[model samples]
Target: MVFIYVLAAILLLIGLLLLDYALGKKHHLKNVRFLNFESTTGEYQIYTAGDPLFQDLFQDLRHAKKTIDMMFFIVKTDDISEELLEILKQKAEEGLQVRLLLDRVGSFRINSKIIKDLRESGVQFAFSETPKFPFFFYRLQRRNHRKITVIDGDIGYIGGFNVGREYLGKDAELGNWRDYHLRLLGDIVQHLQCTFFDDWYLATGHHDEEPFPTETEGEKWIEITATDGVQLEDVFESLICQAKDEIFIGTPYFIPSERLFKCLTDALDRGVNVKVIVPMKADHPLVKEAGLPYMMRLIEAGGEVYMFDRGFYHAKVVIIDQQLCDIGTANFDRRSLFLNKEVNTIIHNSRFVMDLRLAYLKDVQDSQPLKEHIFQLNTIRTKIKIGIARLFRPLL
Candidate 1:
């Protein structure tokens, strides 16, 4: 009994030490707001593809007086991308402290000349993480998927869009990929700046000491929430429990954790109208296969599911009860919920939710409904593929 007691005490001490370390990290992250957007003027803007949002962003980049920090999962060298690169280069030449970070994996296909030109023009660049054979497996999973842009420590941008021809409506093959982005001018911009700095530090081992804006004059209350591993796994469960009235969600992938699946089922039992839209043609075949079982379950619970027919439905958005909404790069799948460093914006604005609902309705109009009978009609080969996908979902 004494030996067991001693072991328990040692375990308690170790737990406390871990708790202290986690608390310290959380305190450091307090400089970055998790779920709030603020500015002095209460003027926040939402931008989408082909909406002249890039023009406003370019104007801000041209007028930046102090520093510019940007991080993206992918950066292509297409026309719109070239335009932004030129502006960034010009800003760097003007002596503004310019920093750009891109994921090595996502930007691997991009032309090397574009990166060389940016570097030659004095723009600082870093890759989020590079794989080194033996140590690559663990490092590759924790990717910097958040897209952030901060200018002069005051204005910021964060959302799902990447610097690519497809996103900018220039991909001749894809033809106007539908997406959403937000331009922030408030306290939340500082959080974005801090997020960039964290990635910058991780990439280059340098941290910025300047004070980022935490208070701004914006009216609409927006909160940015992020979770990875168990924390992320739990957040969706909490979101599911809090959902009331209606839940409208759209994602390119749809594999869900059991807890989340149960929460949605419970919400439906309580008379909540649950609607979900997923891509009819997913970019990842394994993910599409893994999502089939979940679709069948959701349909069993009277949840409405729509399969987008126009190209790939890459957007990740969720609107709860016409009051709380989330938009960002994180998809509703095991990979995003467990391994990737994902960011999402939660808005508590009715107007924003309404706008998102309208957009979702438009997407629904373009989608084909997945009737309950569709799952019943699947062939044996399809079932075998789903089984294989389920087995490999963690990697997918």
Candidate 2:
């Protein structure tokens, strides 16, 4: 009887999720917001792990005069995280409004002492969302995976590096964490701050009414786009459709939804060069297992898949045709594309595009191409295993 009841509950949960997806497809998919911002002119800089990423972040926090807002998927209690915490505490003590948010699931291991110290120092900090007993199944599954830091509403940073020692390549297993982050100085900073504020309001009942910096005359075009729940399908669709000549994507995970898989195959059919670079070894092995079939299908359709062997490739970047690019926290997976909240910066600058393209080329040199034998589905059991894993792509 207990087994029957468990099965019934699982079926009901799946049914409810399907119904929600159906309703969303009928309504929310059409009204998807395509965000874009054309700043008067802005300064942009891209950073890798060893390129003073944390130093630049601490400097921005120290220089924050009016307000500082930060959000990340994970924030550990390691040296890097503690240094950041101390800086934010110091800034808060200096009468500058400092706000920090972390995803409950991702930062569950954060030290309680740091939280207490932050609160004692007047740093407003909170977890994005916590799943309770009754709704634990659904609530805990959706995470806020965006990384954003806006200082004084004039400078901003966004990308994949979470606040942890491992992110700085201090981990024994994952040596030299390879990731990407961007520093922006322009009117678009307010938009990034607003994204942080939205999550802040959701996490805490208190809403911040501080005014963000106004737009100045700039030449760069940057759009800070974000999505939560079932609204990101169209945003990604638009991106794939916009790629005319070639598409270069770098992500840690590669579990594409069926629609996206079809779009990629279509892109390949149209003679567009589709190159995907994923980590050779995933931090979560199941992510690798779940994406195997899709990656095989992608390769079968004439698309190229490369695996980065130097270090853990955690950068989420998409360069479209050497003319446009996207950088942020969203991975090429069902969780990032459909379930979790993610943030990305869409840039329409030829110079920046070429810069990103050059980096992609360099990374490609360090990657090994996917061999045909590795993707051979010669056995029925192997096919069954892959199919089973693919079914759980959303949860992976």
Candidate 3:
């Protein structure tokens, strides 16, 4: 009797949590606002590796004259993370206006001691997407996944790379951390700076609304899109539906929304060459399992899927017909697309898009082709995991 009662109570708790998630999502959609996707002229540099990217970023940090604003999904106390924090601290102590914002749950391991030290060092620090209120379960899962930094109101850094040793590929389990990031100059810098301040306003309730003058000189046309738990499906679906010849995608996660998946299939039916590159190794449980069915559907639709064997492929990018590309922190997954705050830059410059396309093809060369047979689910354990992944798809 006791065992049966305990099991029933456990099931009741799960049911209540599910109800909360459903209601919270409905509430989030009702209140979410979409940002305008207008193009901005800017100079850009893409970074595929961590070492050189950090080297360049650190150099810019040292040269920042007036102000520095930094934000990320995760910030650890590892070597590179420590170096970044120390740089921010030094700049703050030097009387430069500096602010650092991290995702509350993502940076929870940072501990009280580190927060105290950072405060003592004069760096203005705060946390974004902190859990609260009626929809506690859903709020806990909703995070701000954007990683962006602005310096002197002219320089901006944005993309998938978070501040950590693992991002530098120090983790023995996931070697050679493969990712994409961008450094920007010109009017786009001010755009990101404004976005940072907007998020800062949400986290700290201190409105710092000053738009610095930025000169636009570069030929590259870039558009930054900010999605607040809604509009991600529409954003990607719009892009996929517009592809004329090809669409190349690279992401660590592969779960796609239903309409987005349909748009890709429609593109494939139009005889567009669709190729996607994803990591073979599963960094998180159920993510791989969750995405497999979609991968199978993609295969059936004459699209191609490549499993990246080189390293943990953390790049979140989409190249459409070698004329447009979106490269940033938003992954091609439900959690990133539906539940989290994400920022992605869409480039309309043909030259840069072609360049990114060539690089993506090289990643495909280093990957293995995926066939429909892989989703056969031959083992019981695999089948069970996939079952759970399906049941918990919203949380994925």
Number of the top-ranking candidate, with lDDT as the measure: 3
The pairs that clash in candidate 2 are 40-217, 40-218, 40-219, 41-218, 41-219
Deviating ranges (above 4 Å) for candidate 1: 1-42, 110-113, 214-216, 372-377
Q: Among these predicted structures, which one has the highest TM-score? A: 3
Put down candidate 1 lDDT per residue, 124-191, tens digits, no spaces: 98888665543345445556678888898888887778886677666565556666778887766666
Q: How many residue pairs collide in each prediction?
A: 16, 5, 0
Whole-model lDDT values for every prediction: 0.76, 0.81, 0.88
Query: Could you arrange the candidates by TM-score from highest to lowest?
Result: 3, 2, 1
lDDT tens digits, residues 256-314, model 3?
98878989999999999999888988898899889988988898889999989887999
Q: Model 2 over residues 262-331: C-alpha lDDT tens digits?
A: 9888989899999999888779746877887787788889999888888889989988988988888899
lDDT of 3 at 284: 89
